[model samples]
Target: MIYREYGQTGKKLSVVGFGGMRFGPDEDYGAQVVQRANSLGINYFDTAPFYCNDRSEDIFGKAFKNMPGQYYVSTKSNVGKESTADQVRWRIENSLKRMGIDKINFFHMWCIMDLNQYDRVMAKGGPYEGALKAKEEGLIDHLVFSTHCKGSDIRKIIEDDVFEGVLLGYNVVNHAFRQEGVQAALENKLGIVTMNPLGGGLIPQHQDYFSLLKEREDETVSQAALRFNAAQEGITVVLAGMGTIEEVEENVKIVDHPLTVSKEKVQEIRSKITESMDMLCTACGYCNKCPQKINIPTYMEAYNLSILKDDQETKHRLNWLREQEKIKEDDAKTDACVACGICEELCTQKLPIIERLKEMSLKY
Candidate 1:
């Protein structure tokens, strides 16, 4: 695997870091996947307490036992607003125990979504203090954070200059909106680890739309996505959650080479991606204040899957979204849009909200 300098830490991390979130029901298969990844020279493994129903750490501990100090292990804590310093410390100790490691190479403050979350972390006796204490105690080497905030807010957070690195979602599709965050992380000399580089499997399922990014005949859409992120100016690692050995092998092949799409090529493919969609939503959250409180962007994404792709997995996302919502038997959802066209009035894209919700109503 190709390696890059992890910011100012002076450590080399594999470009294709193995995300330990998708390990399977079978323990042996999980180990085999990790073993295959290690064989392929993927030296960075990232996991979190919330992944795979909290079993990732336990599996990683066993899978990584025989090869101590051979890999850079990273994990996160989801502790937040309500957590005390004692709970924060317990989270670190528990993660160490679960990973069966004396020291965590990278221990993150977990998913800090906004400036409010940042304030909470910096509060007296908060998780940030706990993480710092752990670092001083030799339990962790670096402090990091992951965020789902938009690029502009992310830039604001990175300007604090507190973290050694950051984990954020920056995929081929949303890079235009997220590039600012990546720029800020780079400006601060913080290592950037990109998650969802494939837009959560969107590129692979809709390969025809991403054909402009395929640099070589042998390059898969997945490879193009990984290379796209790794080729960026400041990206230290492109994290992929591989569930199978085949996935490990395929990703390793892509990371073995440093071929990346140029800025011209990226713009070319991005235009294609934008043009191929019937009614795209950039998910800017403009429609979030709906009278029904509907998650319009998510539904739009599901609608994009239904309209743009031919795969069963992508089509099934509608059902996944349905089951993910929490509502009373008669509560409002996509079907409750009421065709007021209010969201369209505010949408920068001017997406036909009522029409798309009608499509979803008919389909789902």
Candidate 2:
């Protein structure tokens, strides 16, 4: 496995970091998966409190008890949830207890959606103060942030010199949207970790469409996607959510050989991504905070079929979701959206969610 310096922190991190979000119901299995990743030279693991039905930290705790080698664990406290200093300190203590770790290697001010939210996080007696206190107290090693703001806003945040690293949704499909953020991190010599390296499962699900990303014949579309992110100049880690040993092994293979994707090849792949492809919903679930409790992710996922295939395929998907009981009759429909615009405000992709809901209401 290849390692990169995490900013100026003096820590070398594995290029492929384990994201502890997609664990299955079996905690033992999750622990096994994490151990396998560590055994295979994965040294960086990221998890959060509510991941995997709140069992992610427990699984990591189990694995850490018998970890095969040295590792670094990254976790988060959502500023929106734990806004104040006291609340954040409690969150840090709770996370440490859950993970059975004395200190968090990286603790993020999680999910700042825009400059307004960033200001709130940095306000006096706010989340940043709490995290700063934790760092001074030796509870965390480095301070970082995970964000969904645009490249410009990200650049503004980086300019503050408050964080050692930045984690954001970056992938082969959405690189253009976040390119400014990546460049800023590089310029400032900040550690850059990219989440959603698979476009939130979109690229692999439609491998044929994204086949252009593969630089070699043996590379699966997923590996190609992982390689695309790891090959970038500024990316310190390519974070992939691994639930099983197989997934861990598959992702680790991208680092087996040297990542040799050229700027020309990257540009070629970027050119092939059509405008409609840009519109595909990554299903990050940021839009789930709808005031009317509308299932925006599900609807947008179904709408992806309208872009990728046809309206018939979209309707079929909605029907399947209904029959599978993922969408219930009692759930609020798209029409129920009051156009409060909250979902659009929180959306990482800055999609026209209100417009999409209006369109879905009439058509679906």
Candidate 3:
């Protein structure tokens, strides 16, 4: 795989790193996946304490138990001083135990969103302080953070200049170039690695990213996305979710022969993706479990991308969601919603789903 320097650390990492979240099957699959990735020159692997309810860490730990120190491992903490101090250490130690590792090459504070949340962590003896304590004790080698927000929020964090790197879900499909966070990461020379390089693995739907390519059937969507996201400047690593052994190999092949998406293609993809993702739901499975037996977002997603347009990509995403228990079989459809607004109250996006679902269900 191709390598790039991670910020000012002078540490070179593969352009395509293995993401630990999608490793599947068997009890020890995590270790199996990591070892395979390591064998393929994937020096970087990212896992979090909350991934797979922490089982992901356990699996990752088992995978690299006897491996050399060449590969770099990174984990994240979700203890945000929003919890008790005990919860803070519990989260960190639990990751350590699960990974069976002494130190994380990079310890991200996880994904911080708004300025209010940012301010809370910056306060005296706050979560940031706790992370620093871990770093001082050699538990974490570098301090980093991740985000799904826009530029202003990201700028707020970099203003402190306390972090060594930043991780965000960037892709050719949703370049989010207009976002201040992307600009700041580039301007500040922070370790700006990208996640969801395949646009959160909407592998079958790459054609939709570019309006010009919407009707193109020859190109593989995955290849287009990987090239597009990896070609940009300032991206240290482009994280790929290589669940299967073959997928990992494909990514390695691409990194060896690096290429990029053009600016016109980038703009085309951005516009198409923006037009496609009506609810801004990348099917991340964040808005889950409508108590009234409603599938809410997924149903709308299905109506638009699957039932309405090409079902290939939507089906791929929904299949993964189904495996995660996020998709309840035969759950309430848009037509089933009675405007009770119960699902809306539970929705983090506060999406007017009960109404939109009806309209979408009818249209798509």
Residue pairs in clash, model 1:
none
lDDT of each: 0.78, 0.90, 0.67
What is the C-alpha lDDT profile of model 1 across 1-364, one tens digit per residue?
6788887888899889999989889877787788778878889999988788878888888787765336898988765533666778888899899878899998877877667877888789888888888889999998988877667778887887888899987777767667788999999899999988876666787778777678888888889888888888899999999999999989989855655777788678666654454544555565666887777777776667655664354458766755765333455666788777767755534568888887667766
1-364 per-residue lDDT for model 2 (tens digits):
9999999899999999999999999899899999999999999999998998889999999999999999999999887799899999999999999889999999999988899999999999999999999999999999999999989899999999999999999988778778899999999999999999998899889877788888888889999999988888889999999998999989999987778797778668766664435466789898798879899999998998887778888889989999999999999998998989888878777778888878888887
Instruction: Choose the strongest candidate by lDDT.
Output: 2
Residue range with the least summed lDDT across 10 consecutive positions in model 1: 322-331
- Per-model clash counts, in order, read 0, 0, 4
Model 2 residue 187 distance off true place after TM-score fit, in angstroms: 1.5
Arranged by TM-score with the best first, the candidates are 2, 1, 3
What lDDT tens digits, residue by residue, belong to model 3 across residues 159-258?
A: 6799878888776445654246667877887888788775555545534433353223444557556666677788888888766777777677665443
What TM-score, to 2 decimals, does candidate 3 have?
0.78
Error of 2 at 256 (Å): 2.3
- Against the true structure, whose TM-score is highest? 2
Whole-model alpha-carbon lDDT for candidate 1: 0.78
